[model samples]
Target: MEKHIHNTSLFSKSAALTLTAVNVILFFITEAFPSVRAYLSLNSVLIIHGRMYWQFISYMFVHGSLMHLLGNMLGLVFFGTAVERKLGTKQFLILYFSSGLASGALSFAVYAAAGMNHVFLLGASGAVYAVLLVFSVLFPRTLIYLWGLLPVPAPILVAVFALIEIFSQLFSVNSGIAHTTHLSGFAAAWLYVKIRMKKSPLALWKEAYRK
Candidate 1:
């Protein structure tokens, strides 16, 4: 016998689509205005001294470059749809925004503590990474293509990224990428899956390994 899962989404629209649209619109907005990126991007100094709290949410919408925007949006669209469908709109929003906000907070703290108050971190990579982590955990056996070529299991792919981020954070590597935010997103996603789905990532990994 097979079990059929019925969706109980309050909204008919996809959360993934809404997120991608907002990000694309904001990217163009920053490009046209230019100055808006300063206001939208996460700046540790403004957040701490100037008290620009809203940047926490806005930073996720702005990307540094066209490639950066495309990469994050691609991840969101590919991984987010499945996660949103399983969690529904409300829960999906919770997971997405919460992870993004938490990543911003982590970035702010790390930069401020390091005396790098002028540092700015932008893009939806953190939130997208969180969504990817959750999707991989839930669909461990799902095949994911690396660089549109070699096939790798979703869980293993996500695990590789997680390990890379952990190493980068530990070594204080300056790769112009916010590795701490990536780790924070992974942490937030792990907690959400554990609490909401009552499934530990360890167990999920073991199950995947057995296969």
Candidate 2:
């Protein structure tokens, strides 16, 4: 039997359509209700981090800033819909929610282990990163336009972002990027693909060695 190969064009009708609808829903929902969603925001407790209980799931659909929601929603529409189509919507949603929750759980674990109180985390970046991971894995040659002027390959972008994030975590003074959460998103995505594909994520590491 031949392995089924599929194209990964993110610029498709279905992906575009799904992306638009979700964005509208997210914006309206978050803006419409603020009081009830306070606890859902990402914050660091005295010693804990990423107040992740059941809200981990809801937090994925919430964004703290307009730029955040816009950027993440854009990434989701572009990177996610295509993969979701290939993986099937049901599986895609599972991967998305699981990845988000995993990110929250990991962040909370790190903070708790450090004797921190509770942390609050929000946004769909976890899902967005998972989408980025999938694209990087399946279509390594895809090109991504950054900041409207520079163009770069997908893998390079992923590597550069990961490195920059790590470096910032180690040395940067006032970086607001959630490097840890991004890393967790990648890890969660990798786990999802591993379980669904029935291949050891570590073993697959030799092939792409990426999240």
Candidate 3:
């Protein structure tokens, strides 16, 4: 498993670039044809009733707005590239898709239970959040600039984002931001790193901090 995670030669394609291009292209196409968004966005009603099951994977490639697309792509370019280089394209792809699919499934269950059938969940934020967490774990001491200003350590940044998501999910449920999905992404990523990589993110962060 360790060898598989670190073997860059396993795949020659750049998953991050491919995903970014697909997202950009899809954004323009979906913007031009508003009807297309319905098929790509994850709606509980559409999934459960209409059987539009593809939305589980499709939603990750679609975004609600230009800012949403840009924000997600930027994170993919920054942390994703580093992670891919470190963990190899195969592992990075596993982390990305697993986090996304898992979050979608979890969100679907929550939305169904809460009777939010009309709510449409779209965007790569969930997968991006997972990538961000993995980056922090793999490179805990690395510094990330918030808004190109305040330099913060990677693990600390993930912790702050986790707190923000938890607060938003609890107090600002109607924020239309899918705070629960984001938190789910973090959870999914934590599990991937733990079960697949056999490394504890907390332990890694503590070891890095001690240095």
Candidate 4:
């Protein structure tokens, strides 16, 4: 029960729901609510005053379309639940947010370095990718149905995705997806989990009691 409580709080259903709701709202903002869109975007060099740093966090909840949100959230639903079950909700939330931050930072830096100022990177793919990567780490042997068609081993499939993202970035993609950000988030999440697992609670407790 304690474990379950921890998971619930950390992987709060409300958090996911709120995130999805906002993405839905983002669609409207981008379509109907121009004024709202201005406030919600990652406007680093704002012409007028608004939430400047909101982009870092806000991008996680604002996806481009229903199809986009579905793809990301689908990954979250499958892999995220497993990770949340293993790490509990609180730890999962921390990983999710941290990956999102890293993903956004990398995207922004890359864009700026390339002099792509007007473009703003947005989406929860960064965080979702983080969850999926962790899931791959903890359960590398897990099998995933590729688009519910062919069954492929999780680790191999994930590797393929990573490779594709890296290669596709070289040749301009017509798909208009932020595959780079997804990979960046995955890498960050992988590092975070590695650091986190180093000091398990049992190890910490033993160390504390030893001293």
Highest lDDT scorer = 3
What is the TM-score of candidate 2? 0.74
Ranking by lDDT: 3, 1, 4, 2
Q: In candidate 1, which residue ranges exceed 4 Å CA deviation?
A: 1-12, 172-174, 208-211
Across 90-128, the per-residue lDDT of candidate 1 in tens digits comes to: 888999999999999988888888888768899998899
- In Å, residue 93's CA in model 3 sits off its true spot by 0.7
List runs of model 2 lying over 4 Å from the truth.
1-26, 42-52, 115-118, 172-175, 197-211
- The residue-by-residue lDDT of candidate 3 on 1-211, one tens digit each, is 4554454542246789888989999999999998999999999999999999999999999998999999999999899999999999899999999999999999999999999978999999999999999999988889999989999999999999999999988898558899988998999999998997687789878878888
Better of 1 and 2 by lDDT: 1
Q: Candidate 4 — which residues are off by over 4 angstroms? A: 1-18, 21-34, 47-51, 199-211
Query: Highest TM-score, which number?
Result: 3
TM-score of 3: 0.92
Error of 4 at 172 (Å): 2.4
| Residue-level error in angstroms, candidate 4, position 97 | 0.4
Candidate 2 CA-lDDT value: 0.69
Give a tens-digit lDDT track for model 2, residues 1-211. Answer: 8897676753443643465466557667768887645655544462233434556566666777788878897888788877777787777777777788788777767656665454456777876887788767666667788887788877678778777767877885344666778888888878876777777443544466454
Q: Please report, as a residue range, the 10-residue window in candidate 1 with the lowest summed lDDT.
A: 6-15
Give all candidate RMSDs, comma-separated. 4.5, 6.6, 4.6, 7.1
Structure candidate 4, residue pairs in collision: 7-89, 10-89, 10-90, 11-89
Residue 11 displacement in candidate 4 (angstroms): 8.9
